[model samples]
Target: MRPDAVVIGVGNPYRRDDGVGPAVVARLRAAGLPGVTLAESDGEACALILLWQQRRLAVLVDAVRIRPPHPGQVHRLVTAWPVPGPLEPDRGSSSTHTVALGDAVRLAGELGRLPARMLVFAIEAADLGYGAGLSPAVERAADKVAAEVAAEVRTWATATADQGP
Candidate 1:
C-alpha cells in the first residue's frame, strides 16, 4: 500500500557520519507510527524519487560536509521548495556522486513527482570515511532529528485524519 507519508534517509551507514540519515530512520522505525513508511538508501537519488511518488509528504534526512564544522547541527530546510529551478548547494555539500541529494530533489521537481509537502533535515557531517558508526556530534544530531521527524509524522497523521482520509 502506498504510504500516507514517508521518511527516507539518504546515506551510507558504512561510511561514518554519512549514515546519519539512515540512523534517523532506524529510530523512526522503532517508533512505529501508523501510516508512515521508513526507509534507507545508500545515497541513491533515483530510489528516493521512486519512493515518494504519489505520497502526500516526504521528509528526507541527509548528512552534509561543510565549512566551519557545525557538527551535529540539524537544519530544517525546504517546504514546498520550488523545484526544476536553480539550487546552489548551501549549508553543506552532499558527499555523494556528482548528482547528489539536491540534484535528485531537483530531478523530482522537474519530473513532477515531488510530494505535495516536503521537507529536508540536513545534518552537519563530521566524518565520512570508510567505517561504521557516526561521529559523536552527528550521532547526537541523528537522535534529535529522529525525534523531530517523528513529531512531524504525528502531525501529518493527525492532519491527514482530520481531512477524512
Candidate 2:
C-alpha cells in the first residue's frame, strides 16, 4: 500500500542553494523510513500537486532566494495557499522555467488539490549562480533540515497509523 503522507523536495540541483530540496530528499532516502515516500521534483507547482494528490500530509522543501539577513535562514510556513503575506519572498535562482511556489499553491487550492495537512520549509539561499554545489552555509543547513524532516515524517507516519484505515 502507498504511504499516507509524502515529503517532496523541489528544486534544481544544478543551482547552488536551489538544490537543498533534493539534498534533503536524498537524506531521507538514506535513512529509509518505512511507509513514507521520499521524492524530488523540479519545483514545478502542478507537478507538486499531482505528486501529493490524495495524501494526508505533505512536506515540501525548497531553496529560497531572500535578501541579506534572511539568506541562509530557514523558515516554515503552514498555509493552504503560498502567498508571501507574513512570509518573506524568495527570488528565482535559476532561469525562469517554472511557476512561483505561491502561485502553484494558489492554483492547487483553487483546483482543490492541496493535501489535508501541509508544511512548507523555505531555506534562504546565498548564491544561485549556475553550479551544482551549495554555499557553505546552505550546505550546513541541509543536514539540519533533513533531520527535522525525517523526524516529522516519522511522527506523522505514527499519527496517521493511529488513526487507522
Candidate 3:
C-alpha cells in the first residue's frame, strides 16, 4: 500500500549543490518523522510518477536555478493538478540531466499518476559543478527545506488521522 504522504528528495549527490534534495531527505530521516515515507530520486519524471502513485499527499524537494541569482532560496508550491502543462519548464535547469523537476511533474500529471495533494519544495542552487559537497548556501537551504517539509508531513499525517479509516 502507498503511504499517507511521501517526501521525495530529488538530486544528484555527486554534483555539488545539485545534491540539495538528498541532503534535505537525510535531515528529515535523521529527525525520524512519523507516518512519512521518504524517498530519493535522480529527478526523473517517469520515476517520480511511480513514487507518488495512490498516496494521500506527496512532497518533492529539489534544486532549481533561479534568475537574479537568489541562491539557497526556497520556493514551495502546490502541484496536484488535473491538467498538464501548468508546471514550469526545465529550459533553465542546472541539473546535468535533461529532464527537470517541473518537466517531470508535468509529465506525471499528463499520465494521471499524481497524488491527492502534491507539494514541491524547490531550492535555488548556488552551484552545479561536479563535486562531492554542497555549497554553504545550498546546505543552509537544505536544512530550512527539510524543516518545512517535515512540518508539512506532520500536517498531512494529522489530517489523515482525523479523517479516520
CA lDDT of each candidate?
0.81, 0.78, 0.79
Q: Kindly indicate the candidate among 2 and 3 with the higher lDDT.
A: 3
lDDT of 3 by residue, 74-131 (tens): 7787875654543442345453357866567667767777788888887888888888
Regions of candidate 2 where Cα sits further than 4 Å from its true position: 81-97
Candidate 3 least-lDDT 10 residues: 86-95
What is the clash count for each candidate, in the order shown? 0, 0, 0
TM-score of each: 0.91, 0.88, 0.89
Extract clashing residue pairs from model 1.
Answer: none
User: Candidate 1 on 1-165: residue-level lDDT in tens?
Assistant: 788688999888998988898899998888887778888887567888888878899998988776777889877876555654323236435444356676777778889888888888888888889999999999999889999999988988888889994
Model 1: lDDT to the true structure: 0.81
Per-model C-alpha RMSD: 2.0, 2.9, 2.2
TM-score of 3: 0.89
Stretches of model 3 off by over 4 angstroms after superposition: 82-86, 89-96
Question: What ranking emerges by lDDT with the best candidate at the front?
Answer: 1, 3, 2
Best by TM-score: 1
